[model samples]
Target: MELQQMRYVLAVAETANFTRAAERCHVVQSALSHQIKRLEHELGAELFARTSRRVRLTPAGEAFLPAARQCLEAADRAAAEAAATVGEVRGRLSVGVIPTVAAVDVPAALRDLRRRHPQVRVALRTGASDDLTAEVANGRLDVAFLGLPSSSRPTGVQSHELARDHLVAVLARDHPLADGGQLDLADLSAEPFVDFPYGSAGRAQTDHAFAHAKLTRDVAFEVTDAALMAQVIRHGLAIGFLPSAYLQRAPELRGLAAITVTNAPSRVEYVVWGSPGPSPATVAFLATIGLQPTPE
Candidate 1:
């Protein structure tokens, strides 16, 4: 019934261990267990099925979980809104980003936000553009940094474009075509390549480009991490395409050559938020990054 009791229950449900949950909540195990027992008694049902080894949520607990989360979220939003009325931004800002984000310096922007609004709590998550956009639309994330093919735009959310750039070919310094000259997609069609997973936005740009040119390239390796993709290209196993900014930011990848692609595929980076409108914390973050919300 009490907010603190709900916090304890949620922690226990997440960790599935009394002692660990107590540690997470900064309380002793006995105190946490006692509070949970009090809450269960008030609700007229046991929230957890306890065992010597593991703890699992009971059917009653499962039914109560979603409402509990909604209650907590509502309470937090109320407090944050009250704070914002006095020109103070104090709330939890959940942000999602793609691994290859390069339009704005995310860490620098977040650091500035922290300095400007010390009371605001910031959480960062990295994921694919598609998943990140969906999280923003679902209200699970306050903001997201995404990269999509130039032909595509994010739907169901308010977005502002950050930058657009063509991808460059990444190759080992010793590769035959690492001469720094501009090359077309057909030039690399016969060569094995390292690329993002087939269905990912990063891969789609290259795929569409090749298809438009009536060429097909063999993808010898599929990787999700940009650093790993660079390493694979550095090893001479395969060539890959990436935004030029990636090479500029990573010194370790300097040994690899980046050849300009004359007909390279291009992608656009965007900052998106839910259509419900921006929270004060989200607005502050956008300003820190030198962007304003797009009109609905």
Candidate 2:
């Protein structure tokens, strides 16, 4: 089947509406539908089951989707590689980051990448460290910025350590323990906490520290967003832990006190990519962030 036909099929499968898919592909609905019908005929099976109100992928379509995506990606990468040889980088770069990424200025890096290689399209997403790392390893993301407890490192991917720092205790200005003194794990154990979800990499650092110190704490609020965590702390609903750099960047959280924790958990920030190596766009992005890939 033609690559354009595959593209049409993918668009239909993703949008699940022929008209919307046509709009996305910048083609008229009839043209897109005709191409999909041609492709289905060539493949000897219908790709979609359509009704007056809904369009759903048939079993044959489900089987064809993954290979179609791979084929498109391969074609794109080949074109990008050919361009790279002529001193041009042109491709899509999918990047992932944790909500509290602090080691690299992601927006600034994206700006530099745009200035240096305008042909490279960039897509950015924020997620938990483990999920981002998995996306990078699985080729869904070209690169990811992650943070995990000092005792852990990313697996199944190539990684570079970016920075390491202890997490500080964040408390509202009016909280009793907001006296700006260095506190240990035990000192904060009695206080309710606002923290990342229990199993997330962001929460693991503090959980491990508390376990190590033999202290039990209550997580009154479990939030996925760092800004929400800050708000929870600011309202005195619960205290939390965050990298000092993250706290410094959030002006709204300026009133919150970040206290030094004598036995605080530490985390390492890393930049990770797939094991096979980086695409040209990925390479340019790494360089934009001042990180050179390690030689294999």
Tens-place lDDT per residue, model 1, 116-170, is: 9999999999988988999999889999999999999999899989999889999
Model 2 stretches astray by more than 4 angstroms = none
**Clash count, one per candidate:** 0, 0
lDDT of 2 by residue, 1-296 (tens): 89899999999889999999999999999999999999899999999999999999999999999999999999999999899999898899999999888899999999999999999998899999999988987899999999999999999899999999899999999999889488889889999999999899999999999999999999989999998998898888999999988877877678888999999989999999887868889989999988778646
Q: Cα deviation of 225 in candidate 2 (Å)? A: 1.0
Please, what is the TM-score per model? Answer: 0.95, 0.97
TM-score of 1: 0.95
As for candidate 2, its clashing pairs are none
Candidate 1 all-Cα RMSD: 1.6
Error of 1 at 82 (Å): 0.7
Off by over 4 Å in 1: 294-296
